[model samples]
Target: MAKNTGGNSLKLKKFLNRDNTVGYVFALPFIIGFLGFTIVPMIVSLYFSFTNYNMISAPQWVGLKNYVRMFTEDNRFVNSVGVTLKYVFISVPLKLIFALIVAFLLTRKSKAVSVYRSVYYIPSLIGGSVAVSLVWKQLFSTKGLINNILHSLGMARISWFGDEHAAVWPLILMAIWQFGSSMIIFAAGLTQIPASYYEAARIDGAGIVKQFFFITLPSLSPVILFNLVMQMITGFMSFTQTYVISNGTGDPNDATNFFALYIYNQAFKYFDMGYASAMAWILLILISLITFIIFKTSSTWVFYENE
Candidate 1:
């Protein structure tokens, strides 16, 4: 028996080594791209973060000047940070909740479910396009379709892009409208949950609300955590809607200026590549910290059956 066990171990090691060789052969292109694009750019960005490099000139070592200015001197940086935080916290939760509700509704098995899922997912496929964002911007303009309908209803006219208070609302709406990705994930998670649990819960006198609260939520918490992290990251990285809608200005006095937009403006618009690199690193660090905190707290709320 001992000899057989040793032979099995040798065979397993040989199989694993062979598998790894085949995997590396298949992954060669990805490995090259990763090294040339992602890893190299990250290393260069880290170095540039410590310097002041305009596109036209060599980088000058500024030590921590860029970081200091970002924290203490740049009001636009502060505004962008605040705007990003609000967008992430508010939009992430709302998007996830909307996705969860839709997922639940869509889980009711029907012949039309596949078609309905594809139809709903259309928005996610097109939501980030410049044309769609342009249309959305026009939709909320002073004399646009929404306000026209409002006026026909005897409502007052309002400037969506001219007011700081209202400028970000349309963006949030756009974000929520594209909850299809999360909805699909939730739907998949819902299907994984055993029907026996629900049947048992019903037998114990639980109604819909109680079942959702006590069974469905706990079972779906892992999926929710995944969606939350992904959406939060996407929220922080969001730029296209703001860029296209505001014509790359993040208008309404910068009310819709997200972190990525600010970084873009700093890099390309002002040619402050070094400062932009610093901002990028800051964003990376911030994302890492937020993700870490979520993972740390996940053990308290995120449930897994095998665990």
Candidate 2:
């Protein structure tokens, strides 16, 4: 019995000393954090989504009532969905395109180009902050800098916030303005493309436009896919700008009531924890479905050099 116990202890020590075990030890902090902050909260929120919990009373399981209310009983919920979709679709593509253009332009080798990249990237670093949002709100206000510029140009001042149609544009423009991260990614991808490919294209009588379409675009497709997915997720999850610009009211008439802001209002302002949870789950599922679709379709367009 003593020999057997000693053998087992030796085996356990050997196992613990293995490479895989060491890797796990290194990864333990991330694992604990993911479980504690992400997985556990997700499970709790899923449970809350099906219950009637106001953070005051004990949770009462209601089973799909919150979801039904979101679809059938809440006009604001439906409008918020529409507004969020509109924002995501409009801002994401334009932002990606603009980022690609800026990155392409900045691909030249020069000391000033690096400085330009840093200057352009500064907006993204501070773009999502409350202070930036407040400044953006003021810029679009009736007598703001933008209106002043238009007036100087002999154009009439427009009501940016009062008009529902115009209200979403400022937010969309803000979304597009913070394209620095995507631009940096695109610039990196551009550098990875072999110069020989462009040389061969030029030799083959390919014009600049043709070279861009046939070579640059196809070469950068994978990066574009990655940027698209990430930006779309960010666009859908946008809240701070809307919350600040609209004064947490989602006015004029919920025009900027992004799904995220709506969820915040439900969770904190209205104290509808259950409903907010349901909305959050819906958003998660929606983003997952869209990402899945993009990945599925990417096979047709996204190219890899290894393949």
Candidate 3:
């Protein structure tokens, strides 16, 4: 019995010394964080979504009441969903196109290209900040610099935020202005294409445009898909610019009332924590559905070298 017990201890020690065991030990902190922070918060929020909880009072179970109110009773919820979809669809595509164009242009061999890339990327680094949003608000104000430019060009100075239709444009434009990260990704993709492919295309009389369409685009499709999904997620969650610009009122008849801003207003402004939690879950579901659709369709467009 003593020899058998010593043999079992030796086996256990070997198992613990294995690479997988060591790796798990190193990864224990991240696993703890993921469970404690992410999973726990998500579970709590899911519970709260079905309750009536203000910040001050104990949460009362309300079942599907919060979700029912969101769909049937809340006009603002409907408006916010519409506004957020519009912003995402318009701004994400434009940002991707602009980023690709700039990346393509910057690929030429030149010493100044690196400097230009850094300068262009600065907007993305600061674009989401309150100060930058404030600057953008002023730039698009009725009597601001944009109106002054229009006046100089013999065009009528337009009301940017007063009109419901026009109010969403400034927010969309601001979203498009932060295309630097996508541009950097595209630039990296462009560099990875083998020179031999371009050489063969050139030998076959393929012009620049043809090479771009046939060679460059196909090779970069995977990167494009990645940027598309990431940008879509970011666009749906946009809040700071709208909050700062519209003063959190979603003003001019709620034209710029993005989904995230509406969630904020519900949680903090109205003190409706349960409803806000429901909205957040809905946002998560919407984003997941979109991401799933993109990934499912990606096989048709996203090329991989390994395949």
Q: Deviation in angstroms for 196 in model 2?
A: 0.7
> Looking at candidate 1, what is the lDDT of residue 160?
89
Whole-model lDDT per candidate? 0.92, 0.94, 0.94
Q: Which stretches of candidate 3 lie over 4 Å from their true place?
A: 1-16
TM-score of each: 0.91, 0.94, 0.93
Which ranges of candidate 2 are over 4 A from the true structure? 1-13
- The better-scoring model by lDDT among 1 and 2 is 2
Error of 3 at 206 (Å): 1.6
Model 3 lDDT tens row, 107-165: 97677998899888999999999999999989988899999999999999889999999
Model 1, C-alpha of 230: deviation from truth (Å): 0.9
lDDT of 2: 0.94
Which candidate order results from sorting by lDDT in descending order? 3, 2, 1
Tens digit per residue, CA lDDT, model 2, 1-307:
9999999999999999999999999999999999999999999999999999999999999999999999999999999999999999999999999999899889998999999999989989999899999999889999999999999999999899999989999999998999998999999999999999999999999998898889889999999999999999989999899988888999999999999999999999989999899999999999999999999999999999999
